[model samples]
Target: MKRRLEPGRLVIASHNKGKIPEIAALLGPYGMDIVSAGELDVPEPEETGTSFAANAELKARFSADLTGLPALADDSGLCVEALDGDPGIFSARWAGSGKDFGRAMELVERNLAAKGPEAGRDAHFVCALSLCWPDGHIVTVEGRVDGHLVWPPRGDKGFGYDPVFQPWHHDITFGEMDPDRKHAMSHRADAFRKLVAAVF
Candidate 1:
């Protein structure tokens, strides 16, 4: 039997502003209070797990234990099929030196140079969400968005690898889409939709 999800004020176990607001907005309709870990100044656990699900649970369980409240954590990133999922977990660090994505994208372009775009230059964004209760029980869900890659990032909306990832449904990249449009189709949105239906 599956455990029930208890609802109340919960902590979003992450410091990324890009992720925080979208999650909060999604949770608002559920009548659940959403608080960020940064707001509470809680220390994040090291994400040593090799998989997205493992990493999300590590952080969520840690935050739930710390805040004594149900907590939600998400591990997300872009995965290039040609790169053999090269920046899967290291997507954040890929942008070395002051979180400069321009440099990061440059690295990806360089890495793919030998492979050539036609040789399976496809990519996708993956998101894993974990919700942990104060009682030590946890539940997890995952979402992914597949699409081919486009070089030389585009637009100014959204953050992270948004500029380079263009979902299968649209010709424009995520960064070029409107905020509401991106939020509706993103992997994060897909995961949160399941979370809302299952928990909130």
Candidate 2:
């Protein structure tokens, strides 16, 4: 049986500023004191894992070992159908050294164009979350939200490829939606819901 996460201080094992806040907000209702790896000067471990679940577990284990606290980590990215998941794991690397997602999105657009319109722009966001204890116990869950790509990326409310992704049945891109709305329909939220059900 999986162990339940007790109400206490937990470390969020991530260094991304954009990701940290979203996680905090999601965990807010749990009444746990959440501190980020960035805030605690926890060094980011190399994402040597081939998949999101593997990476999430790697980070969670790393932080739990360091702080002796339960840790949560998520590894997420956009996967394109035509590109055959070209940037699946390398999504962040595609953003380049400056983490300029604008440039990253442009590259995606350019690459898509090369495939011709017939290739289609179907894509989806995937999030894998892992919760780990210092003793090596772990629970993991994954979630995905499918959508297609759009040109002239809209809105500035979100980071990464949010501006170009329009989720199924949604008229607007994730970037165009308010944070609350985005969170409700997001891959991270989907995974979070599962984690909450299992742990809390």
Candidate 3:
């Protein structure tokens, strides 16, 4: 049987400025008193896990254990097929210590250019979410949205590699879409839906 989350305080176990708000927005409808690990001054744990789900659980478990509150963490990234998932788990690392996504995006474009015209632009975003309780019980779910990469990027909204990705069947890139539209079909939202069904 799956565990259910009672209406109460919950910690969002992430330090990324871009991610915390997106997550908080997703959890807003649930009526839990949402607070972030950053807000609580909880230090980020090393994400040594090999996959998104593992990393998410690692963060969630760390925060939940420390704060004695239910914690939610998300590990997500962009995987490019042409690059054989070059930056998959290292998506954040690709941005370096400064979190310079402009440089990271340039690296991706440069690498793709190295592959020549024949190399496909096929790509997708993956999000894995983990919810952990103080006693160690945890639940995890993953979601993905297929898309292709675009040059010069687009839009000023959204964060990370959103500017360069155009989901299949969408005319505009994720960065160009309205937040509500993006939220409706995002990889994170996909995972959140599953999470709500399982734990709410």
Backbone clash count, each prediction separately: 0, 0, 0
**Over the full model, what C-alpha lDDT does candidate 3 score relative to the true structure?**
0.94
lDDT of each: 0.87, 0.93, 0.94
lDDT of 3 at 8: 95
Q: What is the alpha-carbon lDDT for the whole of candidate 2?
A: 0.93
52-86: candidate 2 lDDT, tens digit per residue: 99999999999999999999999999999999997
Candidate 1 positional error at 112, Å: 0.7
Candidate 2, position 191, lDDT: 99
By descending lDDT, how would the candidates be arranged? 3, 2, 1
Candidate numbers sorted by TM-score from highest down? 3, 2, 1
Per-residue lDDT over 39-153 for candidate 1, one digit per residue giving the tens place of the 0 to 100 score = 9999878889999999999999999999999999999988998899978989988997488888888888889998864767789999999999999888899988889778889
Candidate 3 worst ten-residue window by lDDT: 18-27
Query: 169, model 1: CA deviation in Å?
Result: 2.7
Work out the TM-score per prediction.
0.94, 0.98, 0.98
